[model samples]
Target: MESPFWDMMGMLGIYAPLALGAIGSILGCSAGGQAACGAMLDVESGYGRLVGLSALPSSQTIYGIVVMLSLNRTIEIESAPGLFAIGSLCGVALLFSGWFQGKCCASAIHATKSKPEIFGLSAAPAAIVEGFAVFAFIFALILAGSLPAATGGV
Candidate 1:
């Protein structure tokens, strides 16, 4: 029988990816949105760009969803360890990536607001953070693929 701790871990693993991703998205979006609101108060011509930049942090949530889908499986005693390790690690990676990306987006918004010309350069940080999120997503998929299919057979 699975220990109570393993069972709890398995339960958390099932949801960690999606939950962490959503938390990060919420935090990141709020940060970027605040920056966008401030920038809108200061600028009039590039609202579109500002809004786009502010949304850069949302990618993490999508990545999280993908990981969650890939990690989905029946939580059995033998499957619990892999699920907990992979799901939680991926979740943490995506969570931090989104939050940092949002900070980058906020920075980009402010810089673009002041200069109006360095828009592309300003977005580079967020793009780099996105790269890290992508890395986590890819690795999680790769690892998840290696796990044996949970076949509760006789």
Candidate 2:
């Protein structure tokens, strides 16, 4: 028989993606937003671009929401391990991706502040980070499909 701890773990797993992703987004956005605010002081224009760049990390939260929804079902002991593994790992991937993407955005913002010509190029690194987040999101959805659905009413 399964322990109550494992059952709780399954429940935790269901929500982990959304929680972790939001935390990551919060951290990432703060980092980029702070840099953008500083950049605003240094630059005369292009405020819109800086603001837009800072918002890029927010996508991770949306991805997290999707993953959470995909993983949602009545938790069963038999499926608990899979749920915990896939959900937690995907959440970690999203968390790091969002954090790093924000750092990239900050660097890009700083660089562009001094040299406006590189604005487009500076966003490349952030985009690359975003690509990785997308990979995690896609795989989580795929794996979530393999888990057994709720067998009866919760």
Candidate 3:
């Protein structure tokens, strides 16, 4: 019989992606939102754009959700290691990407506040950070397919 500890680890692995991703998104959004609010005080007519830019980091949470769903399965001793490896690593990637993306968005917002002409260009760095998150998401999905399936009658 499998130990309870392995089962618990498997469960933690299953949920880690979503939990970490959400935490990252929260941090990213908070940073960007604060910048947006500060910029709003300085700018007169582009509050909408600033607010929208602040939301750029939220996509990492969505990627996390997709990864969590992809990794979802019955806990088994055979699958636990794979689950933990893929989910935790993917979650870490997402966490960093979201956090950095938010910082990028904040910089963009601050820069654009003074030079609205560069608004679109300023978003490029944030988009690049998002690309890294997508890479992690895709790799997680691909690797998740290789985990051993749970045995019936557990």
Candidate 4:
């Protein structure tokens, strides 16, 4: 392959974590937002609460952005594969967590809309999903630190 292509690959490895995470966040937010909208339609009150609930899934994207910033540095061919492995794994983990969190949030929104008393309790599942995301973020940071600093060359 051309040298530039290889360079791009290396760059992709470093960027994948943030990109995938953002994708997951987008999906998660969409799911929750849709559910929130539906819930609001069913209830005359608590429109503000439902809208606030929809934002729960957006935190994953912010986490991803933080990871991306921390992982930022020159890309070297020698370390590219390692970066790719770590970033992609982290990205996948975050993605699933974020997506499921959204699903859980949607369920919570639905359940709480019916029983306002259970609103806090209903968020447990989503909180669990967020915990998993935090785990992924922490581990990714730890793993990323182990990778060699880029030599900034092919």
Per-residue accuracy of model 4 over 28-142 as CA lDDT, tens digit each: 8888899999998899898887778777877777778777766677776666677777777788887888788888889999999989999889989888889999998888888
For candidate 1, lDDT tens digit of each residue in 56-149? 8888888888888887777678878888999998889888988888888998999999998899998998998899889988998999878667
State the local distance difference test value for candidate 3.
0.90
Worst 10 residues of 3 by lDDT: 145-154
Backbone clashes for every candidate come to 0, 0, 0, 0
Q: How far is candidate 3 from the true structure (C-alpha RMSD, Å)?
A: 1.8
- By lDDT rank, best first, the candidates go 2, 3, 1, 4
- State which candidate has the highest lDDT: 2
Model 2 misplaced regions, further than 4 Å:
152-154
Number of clashes found in candidate 4: 0
Cα lDDT for residue 18, model 3?
90
The best candidate by TM-score is 3
Comparing 1 with 3 on TM-score, the higher-scoring candidate is 3
TM-score of 3: 0.95
Rank order (by TM-score, best first):
3, 2, 1, 4
Task: Please report, in order, the local distance difference test score of every candidate based on alpha carbons.
Answer: 0.85, 0.90, 0.90, 0.80
Clashing pairs in 3: none
lDDT of 2 by residue, 12-71 (tens): 888888888888898899999999999999889999999999989999999999999888
- Candidates 3 and 4, the one with greater TM-score: 3
Candidate 4 has an lDDT of 0.80
Cα deviation of 139, candidate 2, in Å:
0.4
